[model samples]
Target chain A: MRYVTPRKAAVGLGASHTGTEHHWWMTVSSAALALLTPSFLMVMGTALQLPERADILLYFTRPYPAIVVAIFMTLGMMHFIKGSRIMIDDYLEHTARKVAIIGFSIFGWAVIAFTLFALARIQLAFAQAI
Target chain B: MADVNRGNRPLSPHLQVYQLPLAAITSIVNRAAGQAMVAGLLLLAFWLLGAAAGGGLWDWADWLTRSWFGFLVLLGSCWALWYHFLAGIRHFFYDAGEGLEIETARMTSIAIIAGSVILTLLSLIIYWI
Candidate 1:
């Protein structure tokens, strides 16, 4: 058996081809999150401190906060779903892996859907007020 | 023919046989932190749903998140998020064939721990002030 070099693995020049793709996916997504997480945290951390519900809604009503939350949620959960699948593959066998993958996929998508919907509603409230 | 009935299990020695290195520790903790984030994300979904279907749900979620216990949980999750995030950045360098040397791995591991703590505390300061 031959060991694949990391360089070849990264560029898809390796004997086993799929590793490169997964590596790239995780790399790119993680890089995106590294940038987005701080901005997202600033927006969310402020919202977390807001005392009034109406104030919270008004805060998210702004375009930058709403857009950052939406993008961050989408990307973060997408990364989660993929990362979970990799873990499941490593530790699970047969039916267990299948069930876990499905469960995580649903959970990730559900979070994305609910978050985007809520952000949209908050923005709509602001629109009505103006 | 060789003895077919002989039980021969060729097993690779695992954690029990080897000392856990900093890199291994970081990798394991990263997986754990990812799982923690999933749980945190579930809580977030409930909060968002409360916001979307506001009567008193949003207020209730807000109340819980503002409570002392909720604050503690949020702080822990915040640490998890940051640790996982920094560890992830280290992994990117790994994938690019940059940080596999022993010293770099140790340095990055320490950075992940220190960076996460600093970032979490900074966020808290920003929140309070």
Candidate 2:
């Protein structure tokens, strides 16, 4: 049989072998989001009270609001994908697990793509208006 | 073989048997909230797409969201979002090898539930003012 060195074993791959990596990525994104989420709420919350149409467009056209929302959407979706994976693994088995993971992953990436596209379109509109 | 004695062995604690601790319950609820927010994200996408489409689409989204039922859903989602966010932060601390003690876990569990509610109310207050 093949052998892993003490150093390799110490890395703690665990049964799934990807546990640590997934944990670290989720942790880092979670930390980033912990900071970003409050700001995200503030941005969206402010935009909510603005007068319809013109004021709302003017608000989102600014770099800060657009950029903040974009980053938060991206990071938050990434975290959601991983978090959903863990939950799927816990409660699902066999074919269901595979199907749920695929479904959730596609859903997450689709949101990311759609949000980015919308933000870019907004930015383009803002630029053309100037 | 290892399986020889396992045939008659009792199963481990599971949903029907074990009384879950506060921290375990918090973690489970956090997962549920995360899953629920997936639906919320779809609504958010609908709003963004409406914004991009313009020509009254944005107005429609805003009108629907401001309706009483829609507003209630939004409030519930807001609570879930904040709760999941804080729970994520707490998990980060645990991942880093900190706050593993029982007392710490219990306190953090309570903190997450309380903090999320407070943050949700605070945001609503800010939105209204």
Give each prediction's DockQ, rounded to 2 decimals. 0.52, 0.53
lDDT of 2 by residue, A1-130 (tens): 5597887765766778765788778778888888888788888778767766667777888889888889988988899999888889989999999999999899899999988888788778889989
Candidate 1 docking class: medium
| TM-score per model over all chains | 0.85, 0.85
Model 2 pairs whose backbones collide: none
Candidate 1 DockQ, CA atoms: 0.52
| Model 2 misplaced regions, further than 4 Å | A1-11, B1-15
Cα lDDT tens digits for candidate 2, B1-129: 555666767789898889888999998999888777666566666667667778787778767766786667667778888999888888777867998898999999999999999989998998898
What's the C-alpha lDDT at position B47 in model 1?
72
Whole-model lDDT values for every prediction: 0.83, 0.82
